[model samples]
Target: MWGIEAGSVAQDTASGQYAGLAPSIDSWFLSQSASTASVSKMTAAREAGAVPMVAWSPEGNLTEIKNGQKDAQIISMAKSLAAYGHPFYFRPFAEFNTNWETYSLGRSGNTPQALYGAWRRVFRIFRQYTGSKSLFVWTVGYSGSISPLKTAWPGSDYVNYVGIDAYDWCTSSSWCPGDQYRYKTMLGALRQFDGGRPAILAETATGLQTADKGKWLGAALRTAQADGIRALVWFDEIVPNSNQPDWRLASPSSAQASIQAALKQPNVASPKYRDITTLESYAVSASWAKAIR
Candidate 1:
């Protein structure tokens, strides 16, 4: 489905309302303290005809989670999600390979084993509640300096989808800092890691300051299609008090036009909340999806 991540559900809804094509999934972050509030947000999102994809991040370390210190909280969350009775996504510790996160490898004494164990512990708890329709998305950064992708994977049994969070920092400049500009190749690697599961661009966008953003977005969609990516979620908000570039499509009419045109195509999957059971159903063929949008 065509998804979007923003500061809040209302902000995402407003962006989509102005853009013509509304987002099918509203992606947002969550702390352990915000779990209950996330459930409320999910209800609102469901009523608004969108899925809530929560990036579940704990403020503490993964070692604590691995050791079952967070079991009580995890069980409570699992029960809440099961009661929601709608399909949503649960992405735990996204970009965990990066040092910026407390749960990441090499931080707070977290190892690859600790990350994997923590993920499995959470997954097992959620699975015990049979009514939950939450899909687990294992997301990785475009690049990792600490460990290889395989080292951090919690295994196929623990993962429902493979995802990558990447951005084109300088699509029009040859002198950009960092390696994320090579998102195409990075996405290719993500697909390989997917094995047979569906792949998603969990978060992505180009800087507004860059020229030819429309062209870049168009190309990115086409690349996603070719690489068999089931979904692409744009990171549509500008980060506050940070050097992160503005990725919103609300401005610069040309970029908006490009995405509106690209996303409206029949091949692109629209949100089918009811029939969305598996990857094949979610990633419908052009002939079947033509009437959806």
Candidate 2:
């Protein structure tokens, strides 16, 4: 699936519409509370012909969740999603091996056992309500060596898809003083550790500083296809005052052209291309009429 995690369905769909590409999956975040209010976003995505992929962060102690403190919240989410009645993707505690996440295995005294327990608990509850209609995605931030990713797996039975968030955060030696930035290599590693499940690039983008960014984008997509990735979602945001590099193709027009070329390939799925084109056209025409007035 060719997908994007961005501001809105219109925005996300527009990202690829010019190329006759629309997201097969529209990825978004569910806050620490795991609010079902975001169902509105999911509704919009579905209306536009895409499945919703929620990256949920159930903040606070993982052990507490394992011990059932968050059972109410989990059940609420599961029932709400089940009532929605359309298939979607649930990705909870993404990047669980990264130090930055509050629920990370080694952070705040969280153990691998706690992670496992918490995940299984959530998975079991969701299954009770959603059944096999929805899929549980387990995603990790790629760590080049000696990573806790495999150790943190909740098990094959609990997870339907395995994914990695691989970013090219380094272009200058100053940012990556150790020269450790590996975009393509990380994509290569995803297939090996997917636990025999379908693989996805959950979040990815090259830094703005990289030379020939357009070429890199094209090559990355081709690499993902070659690696047997079932889905790839571009992290196409330009956050204000953030440490992350600008990965939006909107800023540099040429990068969009390159992505367009890559997306033209038959393997890249864009189920909502017509809907996106209509939306884009309406917006443009509305703007033109306002200008003439």
Best-fitting candidate, scored by TM-score: 1
RMSD in order of candidates? 3.7, 8.4
Candidate 1, residue 59: how far the Cα is off, in Å: 4.2
Residue 3 lDDT (model 1): 79
Query: 149 in model 1: Cα distance from truth in Å?
Result: 2.5
Clashing pairs in 1: none
Query: lDDT by residue for model 1 over 10-45, one digit each (tens)?
Result: 888877765555677778987756544356777777
lDDT of 2 at 252: 59
Q: What do the candidate models score in CA lDDT, each in turn?
A: 0.70, 0.70
Which residue pairs clash within candidate 2?
Answer: none
Model 2's lDDT to the true fold? 0.70
> Model 1: which ten-residue window has the lowest total lDDT?
279-288
Runs in model 2 deviating more than 4 A are: 18-20, 144-146, 170-194, 209-211, 272-293
